[model samples]
Target: MADHLPPVAREPAAESGTADEPGVPRPATGDSGLRRTGARGASGPRQAYAAIDLGTNNCRLLIARPAGDSFVVIDAFSRVVRLGEGLAQSGRLSDAAMDRALAALQICADKLRRRNVHLARSVATEACRRASNGAEFIERVRRETGIALNVISAQEEARLAVLGCHILLEQGEGPAVIFDIGGGSTELVLIESGPAVPRILDWQSVPWGVVSLSETCGPEGADATQRAARYQRMRSLVDEAFAPFAERIAPARADPPTAESLRLLGTSGTVTTLASLHLDLPSYDRSAVDGVIVPATAMRAIASRLSGLSLAERREVPCIGRERADLVVAGCAILESILDIWPADRLGVADRGIREGILRSLMATGLRRDGAGALRTGQDAV
Candidate 1:
């Protein structure tokens, strides 16, 4: 498809920032007294922790606290900037695209500052990894926003995604397929069953996604047939690349009568939007859509509906709002193509991914501050 997409125990710290007021106190890790109020009386729950994801298409921020095996979401921000726009053709981040992305990052920086995030990690994915001027852009972002963006390699990207969204596989009947469709590239990781942790047998990253495919196969202001052909072409390319992975997983058998069960888990915008449409929602609701199982038949029907709509028409759909209208269909194509190769009864949707993974890793390493309120300096969280 065309488009892509932490708690601690500590004396909960407080923040003065309000750019994007989070709903709950920043989740704390370890054992600490949770001070809901700020230093000043009347201050509400405010712990300071932040994670930033600068992907091919958007800049997103999440501030939350650790809650048992998972974390509860507190404050969040997401805006599409298409940081990797035209990156495939030029092999560089366009100035206009960089500007668009940086603007969004500015807001993220502001939120981080306001929240006084003690532990923050900001990462850039495929587009930046492939860009000739990505290092320069990173330096510029540091100079302007004081937030450096780490351009992660494909391997790390796959691993982190698995860490964040693996919960979807926990309840599955068998091994699951997880993929992320980004603006400049897409990552596919295969997971096999295990009680301790699902094993990641192999992973691949393709330097193609919505923006690249749209530019490569779609016409400039393409007509219906052109768009359809573009989608088909994109699907074909993905299918071709996916064959080897399919072969590796196929031997697991139609019904493995082992101690483990399996299912399909998906993150990225593609699965989320499909889940949203499965509910025929009037607006996006992560709580309702995420972690919900969408039948394979329903998934196909929704993709067909998206294929029939124009960019403008797609925007009209409650689930495919203006922000994601263009990219969702491309994402749908990739998901559908992947499903065609590997069929499963139901696909589990995960709203959480890299950011959650990052936070979880940090907390596990004791890099996170305790709710009682002291930062534990130690080994690297990564």
Candidate 2:
């Protein structure tokens, strides 16, 4: 999954005097009356909203307060729990995977409480949707972590993703494609720009992501020749899965895509990691990677180079490290397939995704006070 920081505003310091966790917020000091006011200039203390996105590979959280038309991130958390590690083979979430996810969620629950978040939404994607024991896992998370995990469908996932990162898309004519390459599935959305948000023309979600594809195609090869063959096989699998979506959009593209004719934005670890490699950054940097457009040829070259390396060599590369080395190859295959169909000259990379989308949804429909003096959220505001 991509990092959850919103591109509009920087994170502010916590109210407490002491330093807080890197992105996670610390508990506020003094009485609640001393807090800052809401963006609407209301006399009451500002309401902190939180969003948690639990994906097949990572668990991430974002906390923010309304700021004018956008929101400023106050705290955040992200962890790679590989929640879908063995689900493809067993058709269920492994005990270890669930344990890892639970641990991360516990930390998220702690942060939400510390920040005194007014309203929040926690969502689980493809992993939970596919596993036979997904609902059981949601119950376990709620019981153990006090966080209700909403298992959303693929279409909703795609919609939220487009809502989150569509702002980063370069200006262009015709329709634009925004895609999210996840751990268990890849979502491709075809949309036309609207007045406030992009109107979804069509979308498709395929069951091929980094973890699932890597596991389904077997381990990375030991030698260059074998690795090339494996890469080809992975590409073939993604291509076959995307065939229907590709054909559906063919009628819309009468002429070939040029820099201005086709616009493509990608929100996921795959595109962001590839963008980092393209910039030759010593380490991963969200500020540097987010919203930057890179040449399609350059991205494809980097993916090609990474695919040729052995697992050990990939592990040694900056940004990828041990956690991503095994799975990035699958990401590369999925990304290459996207490029083949869209054929955009430049690719827009977004460090933001579903969590940001959730925040936008929450903030757009301002919370209201209920008869009992507690806050109540609006319905389907996004």
Candidate 3:
């Protein structure tokens, strides 16, 4: 489940010649009067920051050190824990799922210790948000693995996703859409871009992601027609959930957005996996897939093809394997439904999301300027 990539930090393409807006200061790193204190003392090496995103399906960790404005990833780990495996029907995390997640957390704990992580924030999304025993589980994780998992709200999930991946957004005039299709839910954020950091206009979260959608729709069909029907059902469910958000944003655009006007970016395993397939790569490669743009039609075609594929066929497909075969169709449906609403000619794919967002926030001085030119703290600066 760990999609390994070489350690590297590539700056995203700059915005298309836009003046910096007042009060929208970009995240400043070490110069922000923040000091790094290691286990030895303040005179030791730079502080190592870590962020853990325990999603419904994946347990991911990122360890990095601040470098100028951006950060270089020192270590990273991801594993498909499926913490919400049966939560949809049970309304709680199953014992097996908890055990699976705990095992992954143990690995993360080992990494944090070995890396000498100074400041680390671990947040759990959708599954824990809806589970009845989520708090109990968080406490259990702390006791067992020495890792505290913060169950973040859906709104915060969307905000962090936008903060993490907005840099990969294509330069455009109107508002842009940034989305994260997680394991148990999907978050879409609409932002107005001008400054180095885009200002969020509105956002929405729908409790329909690969795990929930696939479980709700039942397993993949036994045949092509059945699979196609299941895929359509998944799309319909997602469309219904997204309808309200779509209507709310419709008035913001008087007419349909042209190719140059609309900017759409997606950060999730779904998009990254599909991008890898779109490139026909021999295996998953973050360097090639990250920040790459693919035509919307091409993406749609790939989704359609994937939807038609049987589970076994999908498993045989390279870059998918057995790990993602069962859930990828639901991902394709969610992606297609998103394309239907936003309809950007080209889709920007980002391999980074919540973990990166958390790292940036942790490295920043936790201070920002408000619209009225007053200094503010802790209100989504990063």
TM-score of each: 0.80, 0.87, 0.86
Give one digit per residue, the lDDT tens place, for model 2 in 1-382.
2223254433333343211111101112221111121232232337787788999999998888876666778888888899999988999999999999999999888887787776677888999999999989988997888787778878888988988888888766789899999999999999988877888998899999999999998887779999999999999999999999999998665454454488889999999899998888888887778888888899999999999999999999988988899999999999999999998878989888998888887665444442235333333111
Candidate lDDT (C-alpha), each: 0.67, 0.81, 0.78
Tens digits of per-residue lDDT for model 3, 206-319: 999899999999877788888888988999999999999998887554444475567789998889888888899888877788878888888899899989988879899888
The prediction achieving the highest TM-score against the true structure is 2
Candidate 1, overall lDDT?
A: 0.67
lDDT of 1 by residue, 1-382 (tens): 1111111211123222222211111223332211121122211233444677888887777766555555555667877788887776788999999998888888887766665555666788888888899989988987887776677777777777877777655344545678877777777777775765567877777776777666665542457786677667777887876677677767653555332244667778778788877787777766565567677778888887787678888888877777777777777778887777557666777777877776666554433335345443332221
Flag the better candidate by TM-score, 1 or 2. 2
Q: What's the lDDT for residue 143 in model 3?
A: 85
Off by over 4 Å in 1: 1-47, 170-174, 193-196, 220-223, 253-262, 367-382
